[model samples]
Target: MKTVCCCTVLLLLVLIPTCCHGGNILVFPTEGSHWINMEILLKALHSRGHNVTIARASKTWYIKDNPLYYKTFIVPVEQSLVDGDFLKKMFSVFIKLEQGTLTLTSFFQMAIGLLDKKLNIYNSVSSFVPALLDNVELMRKLNETKFDLVLTDPCWGNGAILAKYMNLPLVYNVRWLMPEEAHFAIAPSPLSYIPMTGSGLTDKMTFFQRVKNIILYLMTAIQSTFASKFVYQPLCEKYLGPDCDFNQIQNDADIWLMRTDFVFDYPRPTMPNVVYMGGFHCKPPEPLPDDMEEFVQSSGEHGVIIMSISTFVNELPEDLADGIAAAFAKLPQKVIWSFRGPKPSTLGNNTLLTEWMPQKDLVGHPKVKLFVSQGGTNGVQEALCHGVPVVGFPLVYDQYDNLLRLQEKGGAKILTLRAVDTDDGFLKAMQEVLNEPSYRQNMQRLSRLHRDQPMKPIDTALFWIEYVIRHKGAAHLKAQSNRMPWYVYHSVDVVLFLTGAVMLTLLATVMFIRCLWKSVCRRKVKLE
Candidate 1:
């Protein structure tokens, strides 16, 4: 009896921790920066005694260096093509189209959206489909290893499908402002018609701006619907199985983690399962290099501007480089530019060029007055977190939207690509952002609001991850409205239409009866 009791007690102790405490988590990120951010979240989880693993594309070099931190598994795919120059060129073209520069023919747009439903079937079918298939196979293999939950980048909807196939709960983590498709899927934003990040604040808009906004929204929706039908559906079906419904898969996600803060975005309704986990990437401050510190300090009363386009602008044109150099030459304050290749001879004595610099350290420096950036979400968040002003030159994707939000909030100035070609324009924009104290003060106020949230983003992410694992799938948290048909979900609209039809039919019937009675009465009177 004593031996049996001891055995039972030991069993309960082990089972309680396994069942109630932690479970294996698998993270799939679209790129290296995403993987790096996930690593930070995983470390936070690990500190709280949770087991985590990362299943990433082999192309991520950051993972190779930090083996000790994560149990890393590389999915089999051509890592070379993932970040190569060819992909960059394709991205550039995509951005141009997104910016309304390249005219999308109506026929081509319709074909890509509805019937072709495999995403540029002629072009991407040979290249991208194979890569997706290969990654799916790798995911299948990884599933055999047993994971309790899957965390996926919202951009990679295929990962959500894989999580469904594995019968594991999924958490969608968005690294940027949610695109319209993603916004609809996990957390339905109130401003469904608009492609812009947040609700449309039309109070400040002129009549012309309102009209333009509406037109832009309609075009964006039409184009996005077709793109998803083609590109997203094929990739999802190939992995999740032929029977899987792509629309349903998105709604089935257990939770959504947004890399955005209320400080930066317009207010909108959100669900409990949807969380805003912005600034998760901000970490402990590191000391700036002695030379860089000295350079900033040597500027005396004049403050320095830190300029970098991030990794996306690796092969900028010589003309662009010359324009940038010309702008820096005119600035009275010192400039530190992060350029990949050889320094341009046109750079003036006031400029310093390096292949790389510690970005966060530089942003946090006391003498660093302003930041001129490509306006990547992470870059903007970091600048805001440190209370630095910005001059945003957005290139692609959500960068433009972020820039608009920053500009609206008075924390930054937007310098369009058209302006970047000229020296005077770029110089003037930089000078305005740097010299103005309002930009810095507004950003600092926003930073405080972002930081004073109830919980750190990393902690919020980990809590939901563990919650899903403990519950075996947090189906309770998913919106029941997701399961309803489109007609049924919009029942109020349906009711209004039905009521109008009924009223019209009743009026018609009454008119017909009165006409019949009048004809009979007329015949009787004539007979009399």
Candidate 2:
């Protein structure tokens, strides 16, 4: 008994440190506000005693002085590819595309234009590779760190390459719901149900809509391949080694940390390699700042509508801003509007304007009635976290798709920039939301589900990251489908075999019938 006790205690002593002393973790997120939500997981890991390092471009160097980051590298790569002004231009272009009077052809033509702009940006931004490769000091510093694992964002190419360069296992941290490429990477997303984002289709797809989804999915695959071949592939070859390609580097990634949960997303198959940490970034709402608290309190019984737009929300078109203000004037609810553009000449008595507001805090407040937003993932998730019904005026990116998903879920309403043209139309929509019981009920239900998960999102996310480290990248969890060819993954060969068998059987039937008829005719002639 004494010997057994000693052995058990010795085993625990060895195992305890394995759990508590997590390894050196390196995070490589692209340059933007998109990294905000994802930072939650990284912060948690840092607090849990892991040494976390954030290596990013100079344009993306926004992390404050916190002990959470043990080291920070702002790799000066040419010029700032991303900045406040650049994002505003991109958002403005999307608003035009979303609000323009567009036919089917015109929509596609507009899409082509958008693609050209994105391609240019991607080319310029991805050129950071040459600079990073050129910096011998930076290379030496990264090599010496000896990170145990790398957390990657799928949106950019640098994370994948950096993982390779550092000889670390790659784990994709996707901050999106859908793109055909993501589906292919994580699991099989059937076209019969899963809709292509930005195609304006939902999970409950009509046959025609499914057809469009399939077409869009194929187009998306082609586009990813083209971009990779031109932009990322060459960089991999030039930086890592002669034979390396982007596909090869990405395929070696051990796991995926997808930012989605069933509370907001439709039912879909998930692989063991993929962990969904949807609301990890949603901290419990803090009290609103002094001035903002007073603004919400003034609403009294009517409650306030928290109106916000995109990151470039401040770039609202002059007329749209004025029209939105006009619509707010007709509503009974007080409006706390976060305006970025030129101030509206006619401000409503019930409306309070600010350059910025703590959006999550306002949404969590009991006095908040509805959220008028652009439907970005973080904004939408915040509203959902607080059980507030939504009104979306989505402009671009995944905003439109996010809104449609909410509309189908019965938790929100959709409005157009055009709808705010006159006060009456927008007022009617706001009133509809205010008066509707179903919207509030659905939102509350979703909010409860999101909050009532078996484990906190932060814990779940941290467990998996450590799990990867403990298991030396957890390669066993990676789906074999990742290695399968497209034809094999979709059973294309099986389909072709069945089709060919059917055609061959029909041919044999026809031949047999003709032979029998000819034989019958010959016998009849001989008998006659």
Candidate 3:
């Protein structure tokens, strides 16, 4: 009887927390690198005994059905948001933009061409919400699930729409919310210091740099307005009623699980609900595969250099590839290049080219000396987490900005894509990073700072996730500014109101003094 009682107590201790805290979480994630970040968070949620269900498009490129981690709520659509050849074409445009090789007229023409295709892709992605809503059976099933919250990446506007439609408390695994960075939407971003994405300016800026930042900020606002009005507004009006604002719906999310921290990002104003979990996906190095370990061991004292340009861009222009290969040929360090193309003619004996690589494992490896990359957020953060300095050739999107942060921190050396193809630029950048002790020292310092947090970033993220579930929603933490109109949020109305009040007071005093002077003059005339 005593043994059975003890066993029952132990079982209750283990089972009680799971029973109390475990909640149903519905995830609507973005594709590509964003999905990779979401997957890590989902796994952590699953391990904590939460039930995770993913509502993914039938034509999604990256998301796969995995019964162990989450159940799938697949929504079939006519078109895939991303197609195989789409990335190749997009890569070409990015390379051209980075190279600055096009004439002014040609650049605009090329940009317009790419913009049209991009809009089409956006249209395809936008179709997801309507398709889901029209599906009576799927809607019925999702309704019956009794999910506690909807976890989504607000990069795709449809997720926010779905959450609002479902009437579930929403949480975002966010970095970008469409037309601008997530911070621009939720936090106070002053153009004087907080660098806008693609500005390529740091927090500390010159007078002219601030002017440029303001211009970019305006451009981003215009773009955001355009996207909202054209892409999301009509959908919101048709489905959720005319008063439903897409931007407001996104802003009303219960929690913003920002995928960046001050370690990688500049210090800026953020909201209470915005939790930083920058390197949450990063973990200590696991052992490499036997073949990879053998090759890494062969590098010996000189160490290894690993290069990956991320999911897209399998091949570079022939000349650019040749230049990179030639540079690696001169390096004493062994190289592992994650590539998928016809091998470059100038490829070196020291370099190993594979279609794919274990990027996190290689980054964590003790023998890995340098990370040569395209400056994707995941790759850069992984390099930082492992204390590996970087040589970057930033292609497009936030890649340049991501590398700029590391360069400002003295942990990275960046070479423009065009620059790398010329005048030994690629080789020089590589050698400088490899030889510089400060680069490694600074990165290791950052690693220490990133690791010194009281709770692990993943744990912090999970806590906030479950915190929102337990509380039903984190509405108290959300700033009222999110719901306010633009004039009210910026205090423009208050400024105008105060200005008018002062003007009226001054006018009244002036009139009274004039009247008093007139009376005094009249009395003086009578006395005379």
Candidate 4:
């Protein structure tokens, strides 16, 4: 008994030191669907014994106080940046924009309206910068915490600012960095082959398609510049000082846990510090609830179809919803749709409508034949991970772009809102995906490739996080290109320098020939 007690004590001593070595991590997360994956990451960190402290706004929409896993440092705010109502309104506008039959005037009006809404959102988010930085007590507490690093979602912009202010290494769990894709900010994104977000083009482009890609890229660049100059620059000057540029600091993160995979995304140049952990949140599905399992089992030979547009959407327009319902009624398969708001008048008895459903679990189920999605990153990645073919109804933002990649790979098909609103369009799109074996085959191939990595994406991300903690930061892995000016990074200055040198050399050669010609003429005259 005494020998056993001694062995137990020795084990405890060894384990205690392991627990004590866990890193102190600070997190600044974005609200809405982004937080879903971020929460998964935070939980993983906590499970590994790391101490996590989140900085959340007092009026945040999604981030809530969680004492069990991580501590919350709430920063007081006048109002929340986003809420359910705001999302609903924005989605309504997006639906209208997608389904609207636009003339020239209407298109211009829509563009202006979108620009106004974007500016408003930027201003709302930027408001938190001053509110958090101006709080003396909060700043003091944060400094005293002495966190090893700041893990953040750069979509909010405030995270980058906060990291800079804290003087800690920044690591991003990111896909989009407000106003553009994260890769555009830090990596070499060549416009010729690499499709721009919202362009709806593929890597394999024709002449006109490449033109469209370049135009879309330029427009996005213009928007990004405007956001940096007007929205983020003033805040940086006031809080971080005059010499601090928003663009430099925005790309200053030591590691970028990019929520993208080469298997799903187009092949493009990437950076050393940018780690691809695209579907890190995805895992094998757990058993469904008893009732849900029973429903899935009842489908039998015909199989089941899961439909979800993700959290941002509460419901579709009445007519659109009715069309979808009537189409589902015609099909033999059972449908599980995640929806809220009023039920469609034509909802079939075979269809189950709930406020929420276990999306990833449903997609991973063996009986699931098809996945109807709204083309959000998480949903698309989940579908890819589960080897389910998708019929995407893209509404706004990067949804179109995300779906386009899947379509290009032959794993999914995209149906516009206008198409879905048409009489037989949604039904036809669904039938195409269901009847075709190629869709399933291609998606399964992609799933295999995505899963064939040396290590699981989440494990890879965790290793890099620990790597950063051990080394203090990943400064050696970062590229110097982030520090270079635009002209230097793009080699515009070098191109101009080379052009000038060539012109001078040509002139000098011409002058020497002219002088030789004159001397030859003089010698001939003297001989005469």
Candidate 5:
């Protein structure tokens, strides 16, 4: 009995150190704003006694604001590719192309420039690759510090590669739907699958849209394969060693942290590793500003409209702005527009325009009845968290998809830019959304569902992170993709083709046997 007790004590000593000295977390966020939410997650982990470190791009503004929170490192690649006269020329050509005023030769030149522009855009957003590599080298030099896990914003460039090179368990935090992995991650949307978003639409052919979708899918598949092989693989090989297989690394990731709620998306089969940590941006209710509070109380229960195009739509077209100003000028209720640029002179006394506003704070205000937004995923989550019905004007990427889900839920109205160009269209859409009580009620229902979650999103995220640390790695949660061939991975098409082939073979065999049997029977009768 004493020997057993001693052994148990020894085991406890070993495990206590291993478990209590929680593993270090390496975070690579796409931008400063992403870090804000990540910081909250890290704080939650810290409360549970985990050591966390942030390795982020230097140009990110949040780094400067909160130096104590992170161990900062500068990336070698320049964040912006174009400056001075070159940028001006590119912008001028792009504007002309957009307006359909460019000559054929100029159009070709613009096309080449646009391709270059895509690279530039990627560079501006994902220049952290070099810096992350530097961090790896720094870790190697220290020899004492080894990270147990890597948490990266998969929206940025090549974070998966870095995680692989480190041989650390990776948890991808996807801010939006990944174009390359959309079919596997979520249901394929016609818009993303057709013409590949930026390609020009041609009117010459029948069933052209379906053809376009097929072609785009094939092209995207090829491009994704190449990116995995050439870009992502080479980086891993260069840092980790020559023996590392990039394909295997993707399969080895511990989890995919999806910022999507089941309430918003339709039911779909997801891997065990894929966790829904949506609505991390949600905050508890707070008091509104004194002036705003006074206004809300004095309005005799008349509601307010909150309008913002989100950060991506920072440069709204003058025509669109004018249309919005004109529409709002005629409205009876107070309108608060979070315009990023100079205040438009056309807005009437009932409307207020500001360069910046506390978005969550404004959304939670009792007077805010409706939200007019560009349908950014984060903005939509915030609106839903605050029980504000939306008037979504989706601009690009998955914004359209997000709004479609909300509209289908009967909690929002979708106003496409194409329709919003006309004054009557904009006014009618706004009136329809604002005057309807069902929209408000539906939003409230969703808000209640979100609030009644089993656990806070931040807490859930932290628990998973710690769970991984406690277990050394939650590798058991990872999906086993390496065992299956590509055909088997997406086997619905293969199964149909195989079934057809088998049926044809059986039919042919039956016909041949019937012919042979008839010939034999005829010969026997003749002989008799």
Candidate 6:
């Protein structure tokens, strides 16, 4: 036994030279389902023998501590974050945006409410800097930890400051289909072609849609600039000192683990550092608990309709639930809804309503025929993995963009609930999706492509992560565009230079022509 122990130690020592044992990855993910996406990546890394540490906001840390990480840092939850109905209000705003029916006054009203709530929440997040600044001991303790990389969702922008303060490399965990700042950081996507999030347009745009896409991109850019100047930059200056700017550190990331994939998207350009791990959350269907299995099996030939609204949002209205319930009752299928709060009075016998269900597992089940969802990125990705067609009832954030992707894929139809007064439209939309054979065919095609990828999303993520650690930051993978100024990146400077040269040449040519005309006239007069 002693000899065997000695041999094991020797083997480990020899392997150390050739292999990267593991890396210490610090992940600071945003609130809600975005954290779930990051945890999937982190948990996978942890299983592969990497030491992972997580820092979470106290506001949303409702569950017990995660055992996947070596340590969990619980930041003191700010009042602004904890004390707002941001998600609920944001969902309310999105209810107005279904099918582009939102009027200017109502849209502006919702926008103002959402912006005010978000600014407060993000202001508190930005105060992460001030908290670090005020507590030297905390900062010292954090700095003392020999972290190799800083992994975070860049939505808050505070993570960039944290990475800058720690002098560590960054790896962005983008939870949206793609965040605008992320493209600003690394990719050279043209505003003319690449549709911005919330545009409700796909990559294949008509002339009018492209114009609209351009307008949306410009609007988003303006909003981001204003926020940086007023909100984020000032906070960084206050805590990170005056020299520190939020944007300077945005692209400082060594890698981007973007939650997007080509199978679910149109063909588009992506940089080497940008890894599309869209279906990372997708896992083999876990065994359904006894009740869920019984409910699904009971459905028989009718199958089931799944209405899972992802996470952390207000429940559907009771009346709308009744209307949806009524529609499901009329069909031969069973319905499983992951709803919160009280059960609707009009819920049907065929519909086995649960407050929550194992979404991925049910979607993968042979009995689940169609998914009726809020069209969250994760939910959409989950649906695509199982070949389940969707009846998308999109709400706030990237839901519209996600739904548009599905619509383009021909596997889903929009169920607009813009007006709160009715559910007639939703019922018809649900029926339309269910009755269509093409939806099922397209979804199956997507599922096959997703599964038949060169490598599984998880494996791809693991490879790239280990590659980064082995090469020490992998700085060479960064695009040249990441280093260019905004003016130079968009070629605004080149346009100006070319315009000036053209104006000068035109002026000189006109002068020479007029002069020659005058000289010819004088010569003709002399000859006469």
TM-scores, all candidates, are: 0.81, 0.87, 0.97, 0.95, 0.78, 0.89
Query: What is the lDDT for 465 in model 3?
Result: 92
Residue 106, candidate 5: how far off, in angstroms?
8.7
What is the C-alpha local distance difference test score of each model? 0.70, 0.78, 0.90, 0.89, 0.66, 0.76
- Candidate 2 — which residues are off by over 4 angstroms? 1-20, 61-70, 96-113, 177-181, 240-245, 493-528
Q: Model 6 segments beyond 4 Å from truth?
A: 1-20, 61-64, 77-84, 93-110, 175-181, 238-243, 418-428, 502-528
The per-candidate count of clashes, in order, stands at: 5, 1, 0, 0, 0, 0
Ranked candidates (lDDT, high to low): 3, 4, 2, 6, 1, 5
How accurate locally is residue 442 in candidate 2, as Cα lDDT from 0 to 100?
90
Candidate 5 has its poorest 10 consecutive residues by lDDT at: 196-205
Which 10 consecutive positions of candidate 2 have the poorest summed lDDT?
176-185
Candidate 1 clashing pairs?
A: 113-226, 117-230, 118-230, 119-230, 119-231
What ranking emerges by TM-score with the best candidate at the front?
3, 4, 6, 2, 1, 5
lDDT of 1 by residue, 262-321 (tens): 787666566667877888777656887899888878888887888887575565556567
Better of 3 and 4 by lDDT: 3
lDDT string for model 6 (274-357, tens) is 888878889888899998899888989878898887565667666666667667777788888887867777678888877778
Per-residue CA lDDT of model 4 for 162-209, tens digit only, reads 888888999999999987889999999988898888888888889999
Give all candidate RMSDs, comma-separated: 5.8, 4.5, 1.6, 2.0, 6.6, 3.5
Encode model 3's per-residue lDDT on 1-528: one tens digit a residue. 999999999999998987878999999988888889999999999999999999988888888889999999999887777675777677876787777765788778878987787777677788888889999999999999999999999887888888888899999999998868999999998889998899999999999999999999899898778777888888889889999998898789989999899999999999999999999999888898899899999998999999999677867777778888999999999999998888999999999999989999999999999999999999999999999999998888899999999999999999888887778888998889889899999999999999999999999999999999999999899999998999998899999999999999999999999999999999999999
* Candidate 6 Cα deviation (angstroms), residue 364: 1.5
**After TM-score superposition, what is the CA distance of residue 96 in candidate 5 from its true location, in Å?**
10
| Stretches > 4 Å off in candidate 5 | 1-22, 32-36, 61-65, 75-112, 120-137, 141-143, 175-178, 181-216, 241-247, 295-298, 488-528
